[model samples]
Target: MSQSLLIFAKILSPITSYLNPNTKPPTIAKRYKGKATLKLDIPQGVADLLLKGVINTDTRTYECIVEIIGDEDGSQSDTAKLVVLVAPSTPVCKIAGVAEYGQNINLTCLSEEGTPSPAYKWQSHDVNNVPRPNPPKTTDKNGILSLYNISKDTSGFYICTSTNEIRSAKCFIILAVMQPPMNKVSTCVILAAVAAVIIFGIIIFFYCCRKKNKPEEYEMGRSDEAGGKQLFCCHGIISSSRCAVTPTNNV
Candidate 1:
């Protein structure tokens, strides 16, 4: 039994060593071209293998495959294709809000993401049944739609269509016409005119009453100033000279 165990131990030690040889670590091979460059890293132990011809870095303008070697029979390999895209992304269009009548309404369409700069087209329709004949006019360099001097006729549905070479999107806003506040202003003017007329009539009536009572008031004042009140007498003076006076108890 001791001899059998010794033989088994010796056989397992060689098998383990044979299975675990000096293995090369995995690596990444990259190829770059133009203004853009591709970078790759191989582990320290396997980096020497990449420096050798084991890893192919020789393709037109930097293309290669990483070949991994180990104690195993077959060497595994991987291909790395590196593409550099420097173009910008496409922008998105959105309708922020709409403006009402008699207001400076602003409609905004913005790109959430993009590079080559998206373009904007603004179209509007009115209730008059006629389509907006003209093409959408660009409002800003940054794609902002400013509807200035809004009026009743200016109220309508506005559409902002944004497009890029790859994709396109549209957004819209419905602008309502706000009726000018007529009742308040008209009622105020009317009330003011009515009050003015009422005030004028009151003043004129008092002035006329005062004028009508002026003669009677003046006569009463003069009579009060005279101090001597007299009664009406129809007889004239009977005797100018001194008259004899008679006092009699029986006559």
Candidate 2:
């Protein structure tokens, strides 16, 4: 019987190599040391790749190679695919675009981790917690639910489910469509409040800066001896109402 050597490859990189030297069983690469092994008995006519604790990274193409020693035959190889399935992870729900009357928006859901790719489904419920039907002319496909010409009546809670062969996961969000005017008012209010905060912060920053870098006090008003009205300036911290008028009198 002609002796033979076998090699296992993950995209041409050998994980384990069995040589005809007959000195040892098989040499497994350090990276795959404890994770992979070969069946010693080749009499079974098939080389079996035994693996343990397989993970998602193990999903890839695998090739088994055989070479007959000292023969005209060079080497023969067979290829196969290994796919590790993972259950869907918790999905994230999101809303895109403004939620307001007569507006269009999209509700999105996604699972970060899943094998074979997870499919998505959306369910709607009224504010009263009662199940409701998808809006007419609505498009729900590929993890996105599109709502066109939405109104206050379109406000509700939406649930999205991500499913795969391994398992399923779910996430939800509440949509409260408001009137256009109310939405604009709310936005303006938020902007105004933010602007006020920023302005206040700037004033405080300049005040503290000047407090730390106070310059020498020099004459800033006209002398009474010059017959000009001596305008005394009320110097205060930045933003202090007392400093509303800056003295422009000639010194």
Which candidate wins on lDDT? Answer: 2
lDDT of 2 at 219: 31
Worst 10 residues of 2 by lDDT: 236-245
Q: Model 1 residue 20 lDDT? A: 18
Cα deviation at 68, candidate 2, in Å, is 0.7
Clashes of 2: 0
lDDT of candidate 1 at residue 113, scale 0 to 100:
47
Tell me each candidate's TM-score: 0.38, 0.70
Count of residue pairs whose backbone atoms collide, per candidate? 3, 0
Tens digit per residue, CA lDDT, model 2, 5-76: 899989968899897648787889999888898886677666789889988889999999899888656779
Residue range 187-223, candidate 1, lDDT tens digits? 9999999999999999999988877765322111112
Supply the global lDDT for candidate 2: 0.86
